[model samples]
Target: MFNLRTRDQIRRVETGKSTSNTTNGNGSTSQFGFSSMDGERQPLLGHQATTTLHAEPGFWRHLLFSAKSSPGTNSPNPFVRWPAQVWNVTKITLFSSWINLLLVFVPLGIVAGELKWGAPWVFTLNFFAIIPLAAVLSFATEEIAGRLGETLGGLVNATFGNAVELIVSIVALRAGEIEVVQSSMIGSILSNLLLVLGMCFFLGGIYNMRGQDGHGHEQSFSTATAQTTCSLMTLASASMILPAALYGVLSQAEEDNKQASILVLSRGTSIILLFLYCLYLYFALRTHQKLFEPEVSQVSDSDTGEEEHEPLLGPWAAALVLVVTTLVISVCADHMVDSIDALVATGKISKTFIGLILIPIVGNAAEHVTACVVAIKDKMDLAMGVAIGSSIQIALLVTPALVMLGWAIGQPMTLHFETFETVAFALSVLVVTYTVQDGKSNYLEGAMLLGLYIIIALAFWVSPTGALGKV
Candidate 1:
């Protein structure tokens, strides 16, 4: 029998997005339906959830269908339905996978660096090389997770989704690029919260605003998720606040005890943060898992209908691909880090800009795009999960893990960020919390977030290189 849960699963499968569904009970069989961005339902024929959309129609076909079948007294105006049409085009083009072709730049980067190519050239090649490798890593992870069922799949995706950024940070840490690592950490959180999420809300607002009456349907953001995200961001701000204060007080003290005290405090804080993160995962996946499930809104009395399930790559094959792609990312990151000094030495850009802007963008490009795409499709829950979830991981998992890893390798990384970075981090958390409090969003709110991010970015861009000390 088709229920709300089953109907949502069928919708995902029909659109070629893979998700695991388990039948809970039995009921009367009914026709399948596709849900539009405005929560409107269109009926289609099917029973099994594994049924695939064979030879799916192109953008024009869907647009025409949407225009003709739309229930209204007004004419079939494309402008009124621009968001839906744009999404249709996005769905078609997503399959092109042209980024895979950029993989060739990996070996080319290695060759250029070995042949004494200039810093700018090597950095450019290696930076571009990381983008495709990051995509490959993401694809391989998704393929493996698709086979693991929803609960475990969500866990895996949350844990490993930011592998590219983590890898880059680790490589930079090894090379004594503490400022670079620190800036990138804050940058990842900012980019996800502001840039990526803003785009999602902005596009979602546009789509929802184009509904029949033009006021648009209210986007159903998960209140549970939003509250939890705000709490986590608060925790992140607290974690950094103490360290930043401690760094300031100790900076004027004896150098001998200053570094030692900071290291001890950092290691202790890292341990605590890691413990907190584990608790969060347990609460999210085990204790309150139901709160995290996708909420379905029924626009009609739908009947039982099944759709074809999309298959995934074999586990072993997916694992192998993940391993190989991650290894390639590591190599490229090493070269990229090696070239950072050269690039900044030329006076064209600051280290802050490189870390806060360039590095995070390169590593997270694929995930960023995925977040926006899901938002465009009106999957606000999943979109928030991607954006907010990644930020939490960076704060609780990646930052602490890097600190511990650095200590283990004798590099002794501390959580002590500069004054400006500390302020920016705190401000970001406060602003995002305010925006998400109502569990609603619009393009204007999104623009506000983006505007704040731009201001912070410009501040960093103009700061002289090395002005911020390495703690």
Candidate 2:
């Protein structure tokens, strides 16, 4: 049904860690990790609940979340005191992304008018520039959360991390630039693997290097079943990219007549593979009840305490912004399409190369920043989730949609990606999935992932056509 709950559950299953346990009418637990507790566990009494005399048990949750959400505070900003703290963090990040988009859009609009033409370069520069802006925001967010002793980091990333790149994906779809769309897939994978993961490992390594608390060993992540599920799903997604690249670069012997066969093959394979993986994921969760249930039956009495809070923008407003941003990003691509095409040609890059590398890079910019931010806070699993999740989205969803839309547009692009690209993506998933399998990652592993990207980049740069496997 395309509900976010299913998506969230799939993701939780993938990561092997969602604590949203619900009890059924029969007195058994649901697939999620919660157990049935009696009426005594519920905190009651109307007057005390209504008043704020005592701080909740969430003091740690709030402290860690708030301290890390914003910087320059010795403790949680008493002024912005769990729920309000999370709201404060969201407002700041959303506001930054909003301003960041304007910084890119407004200047580019002016330059585009002056050039008497389109200029994706303005957006390009804007996209890249935000990496630094992102770095600052990320660092500040984590540090603030730490100081305030709150843990808003994950929520922050969800709102701005891949969400930003998701915006860019809509942008590429609108541009109708097959090259840009393909490249966006490439960009997204690279940015997640290299730029974001790399920064997290590098910075986290330095932070943990001091080692006074020996807390680097702490990982409250989740079950092996969950991580494996996510890891396998990611591999499935990355693998799906193969036929597209292979067909693109393998041969053009019957280039004109090749279109229909490619479409049928690509579409057929995508649906089959996507469904298979989804089913596999469902069974992995449903069948393995042991994996979801914690061994120690007695959960702490205070664990169910709810923190006092409200949404930053009311539910309707946040939902509206999310929808509106997608629409705007989509429309903006319309102006950039022609300009970006010319840039690729004058710069002597192939359409496949442009699509495979550049577009993904721009599209994934926001996500890259957000992943690194989470990694720095030592939430490597979530960081890897964003990276692999983005890749899966590009492969399973974006690529097929591109093929369909291209057909409707009369251009008729295929899902076939190049061989080198296909192999590289597979390896990227391997590296991340394996490295993160045990719920641990270090700078050396981060370096290994980044090195893979660099090797691929150098190869692409020196290649005759600026992509892989071209004759």
Candidate 3:
């Protein structure tokens, strides 16, 4: 009789009929139906069983299906939906701040170039255009870094965060705008060391000052890390200073061979700096990582709950955005480079001023915004990494790479900065070294750095084009 009842239940399940509930000996209803036979739960069957048996579609199939489906109210046509979906994904990937709104300038800048608009228009539009693209680039880099873990992530951030400067410098280098390339390099370094770092300290200090108590608070970071970074900056300054000094001495005594000698020295120095940068990466990321670690604060259980470590975009999507944004920036940079001469002639602005002040400000704008935001969040260690790390990259990596590139392309790109610019670089490093020596920051130090930057900018504004020998 039990075997016959089991066969009947199987037949019912096969026929997709609901299993009837049975009452147990204890007078309780067994909703599982078969529970009455052994007083134990049994596997669900019939219509419900199909859900468990159903297989999920593969990635390609799902993607194809999504593409075929309507993209909701955005569009009804599949082709239109696909594009809308891509745009939506791009926005999500690149849109981190209000700064992204300036992305509109990208198309405008490209159009201006095609329409043969005046240099000022092309330069102005592309200049603004690169700002938002840079911010997007920064966002994409961070997304990728976040997914890469801490050490590899730091390297990724270090490399790609300065993509704007690298791309623009390369464009200028290729165009034989050697002064623009060199000045922009030093400008990036100075801006990061001074403007960005100062803003971080200033905004961070103010944010921390609003403590729960009446007294103001001071923010602190790893002193070991700060000192190490400052030491590297000093090394970079020495690199710049030696080349300028060599050029100066040789110009007086060996004018015929001076240019060739400076070029050789720059190439050799660039090779060394690049090698040092590599070793520094190994040291920071592998062996001496502890020194660069942020100070961990004690938190209660509630506060210490797990935070989301997920990246905003998938790995491939982030990389795609990075490549696309970089390409766009390259285009805009090329347009800007082509217009630099005309801009200089009409605006009567010194190339030194543009390279040292305007171009750097644009290239480093994303870093500036990022550092300040993190600093305000009291992440001084991260803020410092973004600010000082960028400068170090420009000095030790981008500048040298440009020299090698010039060597390859037969351009006379050297490390010989003008004497005044060299002095500014040296002084800027000196002041920053002093500021971060103690690993503690306050608003006052930030103000002083900003003041120094202003003084340097003013001096350059009145100065004529020097090393490039352009009027």
Q: Write candidate 2's Cα lDDT for 252-300 as tens digits.
A: 5576555566667766666665565455434433464344332231122
How do the residues 319-402 of candidate 3 rate in per-residue lDDT, one tens digit apiece? 878898998898899898888898888756878888888899888776677668767767677678778877888888889999
TM-score list, all predictions: 0.78, 0.61, 0.80
Cα misplacement distance, residue 169 of candidate 1 (Å)? 1.2
Model 1: per-residue lDDT, tens digit, 78-119?
443434333322332233245767877899998877786899
- Highest lDDT: give the candidate number: 3
Q: What ranking emerges by lDDT with the best candidate at the front?
A: 3, 1, 2
lDDT of 2 at 105: 51
Better of 1 and 3 by TM-score: 3
Error of 2 at 424 (Å): 1.8
**Number of the top candidate by TM-score?**
3
Write down the lDDT that model 1 would get: 0.71
Poorest lDDT segment (10 consecutive residues) of candidate 3? 44-53
Off by over 4 Å in 1: 1-96, 298-309, 469-471
